[model samples]
Target: MTITLYNTATRSKQPLEPIEDGKVSMYVCGPTVYDRAHIGNARAVVVFDMLYRLLRHEYGAESVTYVRNFTDVDDKINARAAEEGRPISEITEETTQWFLDDMAAIGALEPNEMPRATAYVPHMVKMIEGLIEKGHAYAAEGHVLFKVRSYADYGKLSGRSVDDMIAGARVEVAPYKEDPMDFVLWKPSDADTPGWDSPWGRGRPGWHIECSAMAYELLGERFDIHGGGNDLTFPHHENEIAQSKCAGHDFANIWMHNEMLQVEGKKMSKSLGNFFTVRDLLDQGVPGEVIRFVMLSTHYRKPMDWTEQKRVEAEKTLVGWYWMTEDAATGEVPAALIDALRSDLNVSKALMEMHLMAKNGDAAGLLSSMTLLGFPAVNQNLSPSLLEKVQRTNAAPDMLDSNSDLQLFQKKLESLRADALVSKDFSALDDLKGKLGAAGVEVRMTKEGVTLSPGPFFAIENLEVLK
Candidate 1:
């Protein structure tokens, strides 16, 4: 099946037809480097990373070019620099490094190009000059403003009318702007703020222009995908669309936006005392894979509610899948999972199918499915002594006489199963089942008898003898 993504601009699922055969040029808006990345920010990174992985797996890895940018020259960084009494470049560099480190810890692949706004000042200036020459923008009071009325399709992407946007805008109408809805292309800077020599004066590019410049410079005017958080749908992405399209470039063909991440069922906020950074969660011993799984559990377009219980559940789920291939002598992954992932990156459904495979003791199928998910299985070396122990244990009758330690271990396993059954904890039950299988204790539930063997395969009639 051809991969289909729900485009926010059209509000429909459209088949992804690459601009070039087997090639995809995708760009995701990256973080403004002034503070540690919060979980909400990380969600966008993880979501896009999954898309990139799926695209690479389906197509050839060499065919995909992923560009995620860093807004190293922004008001936030300037404010942070002033507060610390440091150069804005220093602040941007420090925060950008932290952002990269945090994302790397979460297992996100680095983009093919990580262009910074600071590096693309000349591009921004040239674009602003083009807009001015075309009568799409004009300079007033040392600030360059885009003429919103000049672009008839200004609000097409966002579905916001100029009147409504003007009414909702927080900034008081500046005297320089002909229309309140008109946004800044560049703004003048004071002596203390970071600035570049521009035709409009020594000033920095506006927030929206940075992305337009970077995307156009890296991926040309048109690309396969431009993605980011749903919050950017408004003035941020809207402005980008206008700026790029008005410059006589096709801009991005497909726009994708991932939904927000909530904490304890509400929007994460410092005032609500539920704010969390990616670093904060990692410090609490949450595994990076577990965090990635929880973030991807929900569909990209849907909100993800993160809680301690949810995180623990994600970890348990990952451990179950990992344990299946831990002892396998072979490393071949199943093709079925790859087929599912190719069908629009349907990970939630794919994971459910994986659980079903585990339930039926399909180890090869399970391993194959995980490989398709971009997590390859590793070969775990069994020590000579451990292998000997396994062989000796298997040789005994029902592991009863294998080792003196077997009795205590069986008792512990039985207690866990009992507690799991009593509490109706299916997750705990499944985890215990996997643990027992990994340890060479096979359990069968039947009306005839509870037969315990030392391997996955055993005669059904053996239950009668145990009874």
Candidate 2:
């Protein structure tokens, strides 16, 4: 199982040949714990998640190492804590849990290791000392700055020259900076801010240094892959590469960056009233599976547009797919589906392969492929009682549950079906179906039984006549 990934640094797709046979290592820049992660943040997560699955599949699960760092120590976190008048630890801890829960809801697997920045403060201080000793960094006014020009190939990762970057970037005009391109390795923190006692002073690390140090400490001097959203490509990744390479570490072998997200063909922004978090979508009755489906509908390298139409189509598609595979047991993952994913994580093409399997009514094959893509044949969002029943029985009949009134009406419908058989008249059954359909219930009549499922527009008010 050969895998090819688009290396952003090289500007071309390359076959993955790990430094060690039968072993692979990768790192992805994780989220800063401040608030609920928006949809844009989720794109990088889903992208890397697919890659992780592919790597684990190719090189046995035990052989692949994946690390995603948490930027727990940040100015945004401090501000959030100040605004809430609570400790910084409380904010980071709560938000970290929220991030994990939301990502899990969308079916993203947890990384092999998640290193928080604050926990690795000693390593960061050590790395900073190395950079200063190597003349790649200097300290002044209780702040340490990376001398950007000290690394001649500073912009190699981003494919920009220093002059061009300085011209384009809004570089700070601090008197402490040796040059406008110099970035902070360490900055002084106020008494109330989150800081660690360092040789320079009591201060926290800059955002870029946190990732560089953590990746080096966790993944070692060099690793196979490094990933993040394209928005981080410029200053964040560029600065990281400069710091790592200057410290004489080879760093990552390949760079992978997923493009940002859009909503309704426009840049998603709160000012535009188009910005939404994953929880917001879930709260609005959009299933997490729907969010994952819409995300994979487009290529990771391309901007993903989240429209209501896409959401509706995704929901319909999943409903149909889950139905097709309901009775199917696990089967072999189609060779073609794996090939599609191996080709630069082309999930859009992989999903198309899944559609072909479904079209041929190969439910077992489709179910197997869906499992590889992290979509379960069964929805995990059912109620507690329904979920227990599903786990015990390995089936969620219609995946529906409701109040006694609705259950009583369903029993009434079942009795009507039984009598209609004897009377040789289905008019009563037909009428009941119509009324239920009007109330936004999907009615399925089978020789075995009648099942009622509520849809997106289900309304209790419309089910009154059945009373």
Best by lDDT: 2
Candidate 2 Cα outliers beyond 4 Å, as residue runs? 379-467
Model 2 clash tally, residue pairs: 0
Which tens-of-lDDT digit does each residue in 1-467 have in candidate 1?
A: 67888787888878999998889999899999999999999999988988898888778789999999999887878788888899887888888899998887666889999999989999999999999999999999999999988999878888888877767767568888888778899999999888999987999999999999999988997899999999999879999999998888898888999889899899899999999899898787776666777787777888889887667556545555555555654445455555555565667656656655665567777776665554545433222322333344433232122333334445555666677678987676577566655443566755453445433222122222222
CA lDDT scores, all candidates in order: 0.76, 0.84
Supply candidate 2's per-residue lDDT for 34.
97
Q: Pairing residues by index, what is the TM-score of model 1?
A: 0.80
Per-residue lDDT of model 2, residues 1-467, tens digit only: 67889999999999999988889999999999999999999989988998998898888899999999999998899999999999999999999999999998787999999999999999999999999999999999999999999998888888899998778768777998889889899999888998889999899999999999999998899999999999999899999999999999999999999988999999999999999998897777677777887888789999988888677656655665676576788898989989999999999888777755654557888888878888855754432332343355433223222344457777989998899989999998889888887665668878888777554334344465666
Query: How large is the C-alpha RMSD of every model relative to the true structure?
Result: 8.7, 10.7
For residue 188, give model 2's deviation from the true position in Å: 0.7
